[model samples]
Target chain A: MNTTRRSFLKLMGVSAVGLSLGQLGFDLAEAQAYASKLKIEGAKEVGSVCPFCSVCCQIIAYVRNGKLVSTEGDPDFPVNEGALCAKGAALFSMYTNPHRLTKPLYRAPFSDKWVEKDWDWTLNQIARRVKDTRDKDMVLKNEKGQTVNRVDTLFMMGTSHASNEECAVIHQAIRSLGMVQMDHQARV
Target chain B: MPKAFLVDTTRCTACRGCQLACKEWHDLPANATKQRGSHQNPPDLNPNNLKIVRFNERMTKEGVVVWNFFPDQCRHCITPVCVDVADMAVPGAMIKDKKTGAVLATEKSAKLSPADAKAVAEACPYNIPRIDPKTKRITKCDMCFDRVSAGMQPICVKTCPTGTMVFGEREEVLAVAQKRLAFAKERFPKAHLVDMEDVSVIYLLAEEKEHYYEYAGFM
Candidate 1:
């Protein structure tokens, strides 16, 4: 009877579709085929710092064949001692998030939408704007006749995420531009 | 000896490091979230979120609003009615690890019918189990069995900056829980440890359990 049923199924071309009793039901074969692979199995660990706060918690970023696979707090770091806050723990997501901007986005005044600009164009546009703004709003001296070579229009916003060296470099650059309204995101 | 955890809610500042670390160690994906006028995001635990910090607010007798945060997860009950229920429906569906007292859902749990899985979920007093629609498997906190077996603490406990959560041998953890309970009671007068005798994970609540979360403890 089994042979006859098999022959009948063969004649009807149902066997071609793998419609046998054991095969007809739910098949985990497809799912299991992709289950053995690990997302970060062979990744290399690169030490870095969490760019969120002053703690500067060290983190280990796992890279697989030049691509970042994951990140976590470094257990060896004494400051955080393998712990991270909400913002620090989200470093992986911050890098791999779909909302992250790959290129610079520029939104002009009174513009409703942002336009993507290349690195060269963005840098040149920024330089042109900074030069024009400083040239237009330069305040070399106050009413009290103090030598305050400051640009009131151009506000330099510093990032809390910057390292000490990076902050120093940024401070020198901004100071060279004679921009006095310097503020850090930590205060905000 | 079995292992246990003592989560002192009083020391928890709602930093949510434990919650994120659990997700990171588990390799769980991010949840789409929106502002709910509260710090608690994604609302509640789903298939991806094994742990969550629940926020609750209440008025004191003096008419002052008191905000409370409860880091909620599986209690790993000693009796574990969910295990019994799951076993009756699908053998080997759920198993309690003898070494760590971790109630874990094995891979064989995929064989459980939806009704049986729902039954097991309902049997849980803490509402810890969540079914994944894509995989048709129920998942929750496993107490990091792989890490624990390798002599490492659970990721959530290791990543807790506030030292609110602690994991150790069952007896040692219970002793710590009792000590903290005594210290807390001296100050709050209403401090209590939730289900300390019945579960592997004991939570020390400063006020009533209701002020922390609805299912903070089993009565």
Candidate 2:
């Protein structure tokens, strides 16, 4: 039998306590209590909503020393009533994770590398691409001679992160450009 | 009065909100993991992860596959075996809080030798404790002692989208567990509460213990 030193130490540890339990007549209720320190005791709470889905569960982000300490569901919100899904519960990581992108990244048509681009440059690039695609693909009319304004080459994908007012504004802008291929990222 | 938890497995959708919430509360770092052909990640319990949702699939006699999810963590047993084991090697390494019945691994656990720490972890019947290779301190769920002591619910229970986890005074939680068990029995005749008398975390399993995890319960 390989008693090896590790298992032997473990065996002695277990049996030593087994004998001690009988000696002390240990009762859990009488065990020594400890006063624990709360992790968010002095942190500032900032209320926010989960951006993962339509539920939009409210959350309280605890920040201490200008850094996020903890995050949890907000009990006051009626939509989720303090309940959150996996993605919502993991909101803290999204905010603090090193891997998360803090700036816009752009890749050229055939480039094998991604380049960090400023917000102004990225927005201008998107606007320029949209204008070019719309001008090249906008259809004037259908085969039956009905006036139809549509851009087949351009597709617009929106996200649940947008508010109702923002969605309305975005939808109007996309429609005005005659982009027919549009979809919302959220189903529920 | 000591506090307790009532986990109704029938209500768990396996969304893993509680698992992630635990990590968020503890501020544990993320694990660099690859897909194991299942949604379960990080593979196994470690010093970094104090809680995890275990996924298992079993084939029923009806020829349909039944899935089971057990949100696994330390049970905080009424008489914790790990504490006893730790006390033998290093006196203050482990402690059981009288007010909340929360068995905790103290910072003094770093004093235990590698052999002694492994023994302390190995003594746990539920196999929960994880020893850090660097610090050699045994670690596991502390019942969110800091949160509960501050009059806030455990983050895991608070973030559960489904009413799968419940925490309250021990008696109140036990009553809730019994009521939930009765309700679940109608759908799953085998529904029962796991280790209610022995541990603070009372699990209302919807199926036999085998369906969940091999260590889901002890007689």
Candidate 3:
């Protein structure tokens, strides 16, 4: 048999263990039980918030050596009181999802593809567009000749994941831009 | 004292918080799902799901459309047939925890051959066990053995906001179940506890067992 170096190592490794335990077959039952015990044992926990909806349920993220081992509802949270809806329960998958974007993605108008952009570049682009839209579409007066400092070009959509303080800051920022059209995922 | 669960179907709005909380506590992964025209996702229980709220709609005798929500899970049988059958195949495959009266599927169950696992699965009156093909392991609810051992209620029972699910000492739970049954019977004449004597997880159904689910009881 023409065994490659990798195959030779595997063969030697298998035989070495097999030879150590002469007649007895693998103690697979013991191994399986051991595996289950290894799962939840000796794990540290970190506190986090479920980012799905307005409930903002608190969660305890179990970590083993900086890796997230599991997540569960935080019993101490007053709002959810350790209860989590389907969306809130799926927080672990949402965080560990392979499709989760690690960088800001931008797509030009009418473009079908998204291109990754750095934080500075993305921020600068957003600032430039907001300034241009505010300058171009700023409404100074209505038909009644009343002073209405509003911008119609930009619409602000807020996230349900935002905390109370974060939402306040976002509301203030949008108002400063004279943007009247505002909505949030919380109501949905 | 045996632990009991009171699952009041009438109070269940089917928010599926119990379902999600069970999955989170067990650290199971998400299953691929599609819109199946019902709020029930993934259709039925798999390795990833230990609890599911089944949605069923039917017309009453008066010709009014009625929708019913059945939150289904392992009943944790008092004398679990699955435990007896699994023990016959593999001595420690399934064990009835003496402390909490939880019928737990030990990791040793993975050693049971496919045919043996099938026999154990079939032994369940509720058809609760699902064998994971990839891992070749039999999986089902363990009644949160770890949590219960550490003086915490099962995650599903703790997370039920509607009080549809409850867990406590077996005697205490039965008392609560009896009290709720008496209250429920006033409104729902058909209200009764399904297989209350045989199972640790007692379900207080407001309708006939068939109206809840096919295996809601063991005939």
Q: Of the candidates shown, which would achieve the greatest TM-score relative to the real structure?
A: 2
Candidate 1 lDDT, B15-98, residue by residue in tens:
998888788777789888998899998689898899999999878899999988889899988888888999898866787765
Note the Cα lDDT for every prediction shown.
0.81, 0.82, 0.79
DockQ head-to-head 1 vs 3, winner:
3
Candidate 1's C-alpha runs over 4 A off are: A1-42, A53-56, A108-111, A135-148, B30-38
Ordered list by lDDT, greatest first: 2, 1, 3
Please, what are the lDDT tens digits per residue for candidate 1 over residues A1-188? Answer: 55653245234343223333223222334223212233444467789998778678889888988998777777778888778888887788788789988999989899999999999999998899999999998888999999899898899888866878999999999998889888877787
Q: Please identify model 2 stretches exceeding 4 Å from their true place.
A: A1-36, A138-150
Query: Residue-pair clashes per candidate, as listed?
Result: 0, 0, 1
Q: In candidate 3, residue A180 scores what lDDT? A: 97
TM-scores of the candidates are 0.81, 0.85, 0.83
Candidate 3 docks with a DockQ of 0.17
Question: Which stretches of candidate 3 lie above 4 Å from their native place?
Answer: A1-46, A141-146, A159-168, B32-38
**Residue pairs whose backbone atoms clash in candidate 1:** none
Total backbone clashes of candidate 3, pairs 3 or more residues apart or in separate chains: 1
Candidate with top lDDT is 2
Write one digit per residue (lDDT tens) for candidate 3, span B13-34.
8889888878877778889899
